[model samples]
Target chain A: MVSTQARNALAALAATAGMAAFVAGCGTTSDGSDSASSGSGGCKAVSIAYLGAKTGDSANLGLNMVGGVKVAIDDYNKAHPDCKVTEKDFDSQGDPEKATPLATQIINDSSIVGVVGPGFSGESDATGKAFSEAGLVTISASATNPALTTNGWKTFHRVLGNDDTQAPADAKYITDTLKAKKVFVVDDASDYGKGLATGVKKSLGSLVGGTDEIQQKQTDFGPTVTKIKASGADTVFYGGYYAEAGLIAKQLRAAGYKGYFVSGDGSLDPGFVKAAGSTGAEDARLSCPCGPASADFTTKYKADNNGKEPGTYSAEAYDAAKVLLDGIAAGKTTRPDELAFVNSYDQPGLTKQIKFTPTGEVTDAVVYAYTVKDGKIGDATVIK
Target chain B: MQFFFDHFFELTITGLALGSIYALVALGYTMVYGVLQLINFAHSEVFMYGTFAVIWVFTAFGAGGHTSTGGIIGLLIVSVFAAMLVSGGIALLIERVAYRPLLKRNSPKLVALISAIGASFALSETMGLRDRITGFVGLDKPLADYVNGARDNSSLPVEITPKAVFKIGDYSVTTIDLLVIITALVMMVFLDRFVRRSRAGRGMRAVAQNPEAAALMGVNAVRVRQITFLLGGMMAGVAATLYMIRIGTTRFDAGFILGVKAFTAAVMGGIGNLRGALLGGLVLGVAENWGSAIIGTQWKDVVAFILLVVILLFRPTGLLGESLGRARA
Candidate 1:
């Protein structure tokens, strides 16, 4: 009886496998026609897809990018009514698994001329290959992993400086300005965080007191706090987003560590202060490539978003969207034309002159330092 | 050796505080397993709901900053009660929705376990998507704010400041630590004594031993199982409040790893044993901290599982052995 049951199960599995293969073959043939038609004949209403987490832990950053994209789209439509553009937003929730299908959808959707972002490095890394293969040009506002540009993706571009550019300023602030004899580094063990942490470590050299890694979404930092306390480093530089950074900062302070706590742009959110509490976030500094949006842009954004000022990458996101919109306005409708246009694209933007290297990095992006004073992110000071 | 000695007192206090939370959460897992002989994987969601309950309560009251001692005590009492009540309700709901139907149909234990895993995901994802749900309901202003606040680590305004009560060596004992450790001990002791000398507790033991026998002996087996989940969830609720107070922040998935550790504690302390849960939690917590101190922080979780494996290898029945249902036999 058992042998018969096993044989039947194997037979059923083989039949199902055969059926799936037949279906998949049909699916590919249909998909090829769909992409071919969309690629050649652009839709009457062109869309710039905004892809990122608009609802999860990283929603603050993603929403800001969306807001910036919205403003750029609106500005472009008002200026050029004859060549109108629309925006398509996809919420990846800052998860790579979610971004993969969304990337495919964006690629298959022929109406999408360009992308404003895959706001996070993880999502960009996950979807870059698909976008590159589909010849979809994605101008990321915030993804800054140095390796993202080196992935041989011809259609990928970012408006913000990568870790390679940002880390030198961070190391300088830690070693020269703070002048700490000893420094400890912590990362969330992501492609972005580890890259930035390692870069800082290389710059600091012998001044590096200790180094540690943490997982994303990890809450309890009791052991990590103890380890940091024992390290006796005068400065602690954390390379992670706000959620973990705030908790670590709070726990570290509660444990009576009075040293300087520095973090990267990933932690530059109002939520950081809210998470760290007033006392815990005291004197903490956040370094980022993008600063506050321009005064006029800030006022306009506040009006648009119920008096909510744009967050960390809002200015850069606006710049990124502007770059793509400018390319679209210049009659770069098809994916290949837009990709080529963005490659040689040079225009003044909200944050900086929007120009990309052959590798798709912003050539003249500047890093800025912002200190947390009185429980708020203070005005940015340009860090040379 | 010097590092260990220097940080000994600090580590010990931190470990004890951490252990107290594990013990509280582990009781729910242990008690449910004691009666059902199945892991209610959704017990973690019960604890997570308790954390949000405290957040909702505190936020509703606008509780923030340093409160007066009396105010702090009052807030703690109210929040703890709120957490317990919400968690208990959710636990009962889970058992009713996820476990009772399976029990009635006499389904396999694996099916019930799978149901519990589904319930766990459903609860956590609901919390994660609370904002979207609330917005859909058209209560977008304040309700959306509350739900979105929980999307990430919602840092509660510290209602009670952790003042240094005393110093042992270079480590100072804070009031929050004392509160967590003391509250956990009190709850555990009360639970221990109650289980040893209560009608319901006896019913629980009878049901655990043999449901048919217990049903024959005038104890409602189903009711006893529900009560067991209730008691366990209440304990977890108290654990949640203490956790939020000690950690000062709670996220939607906060209970996951901690729940795993608590389950490991339950298994380590002899799955069905009451005292074993406490012993297992304290031992696991201290050992994890010490292991991290020695090896590194990233390997802290690795150290915890390794210890669990080593202990189980030595004594498969666990350190204390299963004794929940045995009546002095």
Candidate 2:
């Protein structure tokens, strides 16, 4: 396991070139959790930590969250350079096993007052209890497994709806919008994928033709495709991230399924279209709980990051990070105070209106249905 | 059970295609093992580089778009040659850098094994971190298309999507299946002829049987070893090209699992035997697909190894006895 202090010191030095004083200050506060210099509107080098996949198979998805967090940090730093908070990356690689040890190391750091993400569902489930026990605030931008909230982690909060909200809406879109009579459900057998598939299966009770489970990195979908084609399903609904989902979509089209393909938020990125090919991805419906990005925010985000478009939950991540930054700006520099401030956070964000249930579920969610046209996932229109 | 029987033919054909990839890649493992009596773990990186060569050559040709059949054929020939060149070069370099030093030092076989594993990691990271490497040399922007997405999947979507050529029962059979299987067979036949009838093949066999004796007989043991690695690398190049055509995407780490499967195929076929690789690959592929169809698609990964275990239990020397030294010459 990587020591958080070492990673942070190295990153701080490389990123700033002159954070020796801040590094020394953080060292002094490493123990006795309450050792940080507090009680002022201006913070003393307290930072926001990003816990997500910086590298791995789902890295493309996790990177969008990193982009959002980066934007928030830039905005905050620009507004107040006097108290510039650093952002350290703890790359969990979206694997629960990797995330658990990283989570332990993260809680041991006194400088990281809040966390922006534990991106995927499984990683969130693995790291949530540690953050809660340490009284550290964590707001996930994308993890949608519904069972997450049932764990009773007080510091846990989400900017997007759970799988229960998104999956039912996705099923409705598949049935009403596409008018599909038979739907074959497939999951990557992940916590997020299985949970979402269960909801879709329940909602599309009679319409489901068959269901199958696929492994995460297993590329050959030949047997599953054979089964789906044999079942005579009109539409194939995949519950997985873009990495696998896009390949599944491509293989299905190649096998002459010739039916509509549907997926949830996990497949909403440009990578999906690239994976499925321009023509293969045409007319594929993607249901996401992420509200449409405001034009101003989109333009700003693009300019901020090499003209690359925001991915599925980038907007929600931007909002989640801003919420934590706002808490710090308002004098909540410690973990407990930051948690309290986020617990009562209620404001309109770039993505949606932010308010949470007592159980940490977002008060309401609006799912948007997006379709691929000419190899591009077009702008979203409200579906639920 | 009924689904397995009904779709068995379809599963078998596609399985054969997937197995062809394993067979071609397995030849690399079996050949190197035959010559050096060392598992060339870094051979997977040789395969991966060849896939990138295919992608890069195509990307540079017509900006990755060609509609006409002639254009596609021209692209295919040029890309395959490019893949073979790149893969063959990397294989030679690995021989020089990773294995040759250890061999010269008369190091323990375990030390050479560690060197091969280290070479595997080094080669994998070099490809994975290509963007940074190119950037460090101030060529990132100039070489954006190649170096970009250093770690993510480099998807090469089919421009001319393959059409179904025929129907086997209810399943539509496509050209990709035929192309992959036929290519593997051609390469295998060519390799077999080269190993059996050619002078260099005779030298290789002599070296494998007894390197010191072959050296005394003026066989040039080092040259024979180099030829073995070169042949294996070219075969890996063929496998890489087929994989790109069928899978339509490649990542830095793409070779790991496929390499494991191919190695398993080689072991199942008796590690040093040539023909055994093809047989083991086809069997494993068909068994896994059938296993998925019966138990569930989720069990597909374990099915191959489980079958291997069962087969190994019965035939420890593998389906065919291990023999490159004892080939019926």
Candidate 3:
């Protein structure tokens, strides 16, 4: 065995060396971050970027979008191996602050001809200007904020219905459909969550009982639960992502709440079931601008994803990726040409009538109300 | 004000439970500061590792809704020991890797602090990248259950319907909350005693007061440091286990905010004083609760910091007074 003094000296040397290495390198210990944003040296040099929370609260939603883009890229490359396009993954963690730098990064990478998402509405709002100025096309699968369309970003387009259609339908389902007497509206204080909450509360009007706003990534809901209990509401509508929605639902149940739990598209994911506990998640209602995937797309996605089902916005993201890939297939190779192609785009895609109004919203998009039954997000019914 | 009082008991219980977790975590910060004269920021990761250990044990047992109450108790015992062992081991490793070399070279305090910060980032990011790391070794598929969403929150498999053991006012005191508070109080008491009574504890106290003197008096500085980290880390493990039971979720970055809060608790209680950590944590928890009730829930974090600033301005030594070195041994 080495002597004590020698061991001490060796440890000191090792730690100092380790410190040097860490200080010099940035903290990306994972090989998980995909290759460079830009790929070159070919006729198919243009790349499509998937932007959203690849790893943070509600990452499932972002990963769903990424997976969709992946399927599209994999299928396209398989068909044309000689001229295969590349894809980029920019994980924003669904935060606007994080998305800003990523938006700049995406813009700097000239090969990123189009973006599949900035995922949530807040980041979409934050990054839309830069992408618009840079003439980069983005088609979000799940950003449903009505204000996003009003922002006049020529580069902004979405495959799903906006929250303008969703919130009212959600509110109506809570009031007229569920026939709730009292409603308590809660928001996680996101651009997406708050906007939907406002619409939902307005629609509920006299039926609304109380309201509260929580932060993203907040774990404890004790005080909030007390407030909700005091309100004595029959239904609580959560305007937030699935993670927090699941938590609030779990806490509500723990505190002996027997009311209905409702939430928007942000809270509509398989993650909710895992988070809210199987029993607690039952009967919880959700509204989304998406529907069940077609049999073929589900088969393809499951085959590639180890039998993982396509979560919320997966099919729409596929359609969004298809738009970009189709533009590329038709030789609209440059970012500007891709934007031009999208401006006049219309097709019967996988999820909807793949067409955009001047504001870049799909005209025939439908909103569906879903319920959690037996720990699964149950089948959807067209609510609007 | 009225709403707060109306729900005072419930908030108090909730606050206490949360505060206890903070207190347990704070002890790691306070004790490390006491002896090493350095804040172990990676102490949070020590707690985080404990939390993951707790989840892994439960996953291994396949503990869930169907788990009998007796089975849960057995699982809880096993999980606690597993968490303690992992946390304690990690704590010792951290001291050896992050602190020992610096101490050997007589580095500046700032450099030491930076070293600890680097260690902190390295530890948390390494956990966040567990999936990719496992993938490198072709173990990703086998370890998918543990590492599938390394950066995301992984919850306990159990679906618990928290049963109220008692009632106060309109609130029902759940068994989980009671267990969290009691467990924390017991650990704090035990740690306080250990620091005051045991041989290793005496060595730790001697070092905190006068490292050179303690060294002259035949106390092994390295061993003292290791013991300090071990005890502090075990405390964090207890906190982690309770956190798993109470909050039922843990993320890779879960430690960041909680670490900040626990550090705040250590400071508010008078950093380095054991009793101060307990008082500071409880007060911070209840104060935020009451503050939220009066103003709004969104202002809770703002209230916590405002209280900290007030505490710092008036009582800089914290509620108990700073310096474990100077405290009665």
Q: Whose TM-score is greatest here?
A: 1
Tens digit of per-residue lDDT, candidate 2, span B1-329: 88888888889898889998998999889888888899999988999999999889877774443347777767778888899999899899899999998898899999999999999999999999899899999999999988898877887634547678888887678988988999999999999889999999989888888999988999987788889999999999989998888877788988898889999999898787888887888887788788889999988878889989988999997888677767742
| Cα lDDT for residue B2, candidate 1 | 63
Write down the worst ten-residue block by lDDT for model 1 chain A.
A1-10
Give the runs in model 3 whose Cα sits over 4 Å from its true position: A1-157, A295-297, A300-308, A318-355, B326-329
Error of 1 at B98 (Å): 2.2
Worst 10 residues of 2 chain B by lDDT: B61-70
DockQ head-to-head 1 vs 2, winner: 2
| Candidate 1 per-residue lDDT over residues B191-300, each given as its tens digit | 88877789999889888888888999899888898899899999999999998887767777887988899999999988888888998998888887787677876777
- Judged by DockQ cut-offs, the docking class of candidate 1 is acceptable
lDDT of 1 at B37: 94
- Candidate 3 lDDT, A1-384, residue by residue in tens: 011222233233333333332332222212112222233334545678887766554566677887778888889989877677777777666767666777887787766789998787777888899999999999988777678889878999988887688888898789777899999999988767888899999988999998998888888888999889988999999998877899999999888889999998777777788888887788999888887777899889988788888877788889999999999999998989999998788998887788899998988778788889988899788774
| Pairs in clash, predicted candidate 2 | none
Ranking by TM-score: 1, 2, 3
Can you tell me which runs of candidate 1 are displaced by over 4 Å?
A1-60, A76-115, A118-138, A151-155, A324-348, B66-70, B140-142
- Give the winner by DockQ: 2
Q: Which of the predicted structures, 1 or 2, would earn the higher TM-score when compared with the native?
A: 1
Q: Name the best candidate (by lDDT).
A: 3
Model 2 DockQ class: medium
Model 2 TM-score, 2 decimals: 0.84
